[model samples]
Target: MSKLWLNSDKNESVFIKLFQIINNKYPNYASQWLNSLKDFGKDWEDEISNNISKVFGPEYNDRWEEAATGYAEFCTEALRAQVFFEKHGYYKASSYSDIVKECYHDADYMKVRYLPGQYLSHYIWPHHQKMLRHFVRELIPKIICEVSIFYEVGVGCGMYSQRSLQMMPKAYGVGYDISDYALEFTFNVIKKHNLQERYEIKNQDIISSPIEKKADFIISQEVLEHLEDPQNFINGLYNATRPGGWGYITAAINAGHTDHIFLYRNPEEVRTQIEKAGWSIYDEQIESNYMEKPIELRPTIVGYLARR
Candidate 1:
């Protein structure tokens, strides 16, 4: 493995150690992926590494291995979905129940691989990395008033809520998700961050039972595409947010995964849906996978910062 990405002598750091693990596991692909991130500079890599080390402590290496494994599995599933989409012009699965059975309810897969892989992707994948930076640097700083409470819908690995609480030191958070494994993973993450007192996890589906207690801020990242009715979900987000409250919602457009059900063709469709749900868009970010395919077939992600 190359040390070109490291800024200091902390070669045994979680970030450097994970890079070595990835190189050992998938040398060719890892080389290309690491090279793609070279332009981001060592400071970017150090921040991510330090964050992971702080969050996971001694178990960072173990978690990083799981993330690398999960990333490989995720990529394989994505490639298969891409092939299916190319031939069919749509995502493979439509029913939410099927995904629940195959993905959310699968304890072994969700806990050991899928969720960890997803957690890792937030720092590794360029698009996800950009989204995280946008949320931390651009979105959170926009809230001028002191945040008392916030909600994260479908808090996969709980990184967003954890990061939010870190920034808003006095704020409390509630995370809602249907998957027990996801909730468990999030609970561990919160505990890791020593935020057990400030964060609460609930095994509830917001789409079925919208949260009655409105929050000062709400976040639903990459969750819109998983539901059968994203519009209803967005409405639920709107209702859960107090008037003049802020929201950060995001979705995958033309992106295929085993669990992704709803297919968004473009960013406009997503922007229109959020606007219909009564969120006044303050700012937005759209990133494509940069595949050579046409716009409709390319994988894309769209995020919004809105005021309800």
Candidate 2:
């Protein structure tokens, strides 16, 4: 029962191909798989990009078809899993029932994503490089002289971090994330820009990071929507910042987008959460798609400035 790749009316071969590579040789179910792709189309294009980011992602410019094919492979894997489980009466089902738990193995859903996704934000929005400059110039106060530390959590590929460093010229940062692959990607980007002499970053779960450094400021842009645990992340933010230190968190609110677990219908909810976690809003701003500035939320961006 090999998986078969399904194509939409538009010849877009959804994620079924990727699943096929991992599951069986080919994929099965034409209509069902096509429907899933249709369902996924309900999401905005940006959401679609984020959902399969590990595939086509950001860096690769002209490879969306390839990513879609990869996604098909992933879907086939799901089908194979379901068929295998049904045939062998594989322990019925459980809370964590996405993997093959036949005899003695815990190899579940870490199958793909070993290479980490390309930078979706910076890639989709080339002006994000300029936007980073805007943030640095707007936030970095004319303060005491020294190589200041600008911390960026969830620093995907260090693009923003590098841009910020370029704007300030004497500042470095600790780009933090939960994935070593992401950290490595950022490291490579930083090295390409030759900023390693100043920056010190690591692949760490911000929610559980033990190392504490009181940053002068922190920036987390376009990352909150993906967080499944916003509260703990807020607490982690509190712990990461020094007294009177500040943060810039930009997110997509209320928009039914991709990987959006903690929905923010409005900016106040995020502000409220941060306040509840013992932080205060130094300032906050909202940008709808109508604005000309890059920071303007085109259907999903919400930006906040808070103090800890």
TM-score leader: 1
TM, every model: 0.92, 0.56
Backbone clashes for every candidate come to: 0, 22
lDDT of 1 by residue, 139-257 (tens): 78878364799999999988898889888888999999999999899988888778889999999988777799999999999999998999999999999999999999999998888
Off by over 4 Å in 2: 1-120, 123-133, 141-147, 290-298
In the order shown, the candidates' Cα RMSDs to the true structure are: 2.3, 11.7
TM-score of 2: 0.56
Q: Per-residue alpha-carbon lDDT of model 2 for 1-308, expressed as tens digits?
A: 31223332332333433333323422342343333344335342333334344334344333454433434444444345434433543323332112113210222222222122223333222233234434655655432243378788877556667666666677768888665555666776677666788787776767665547778677787766556667777777777778877777777653332233455666677777778888787656554432442322223455667777
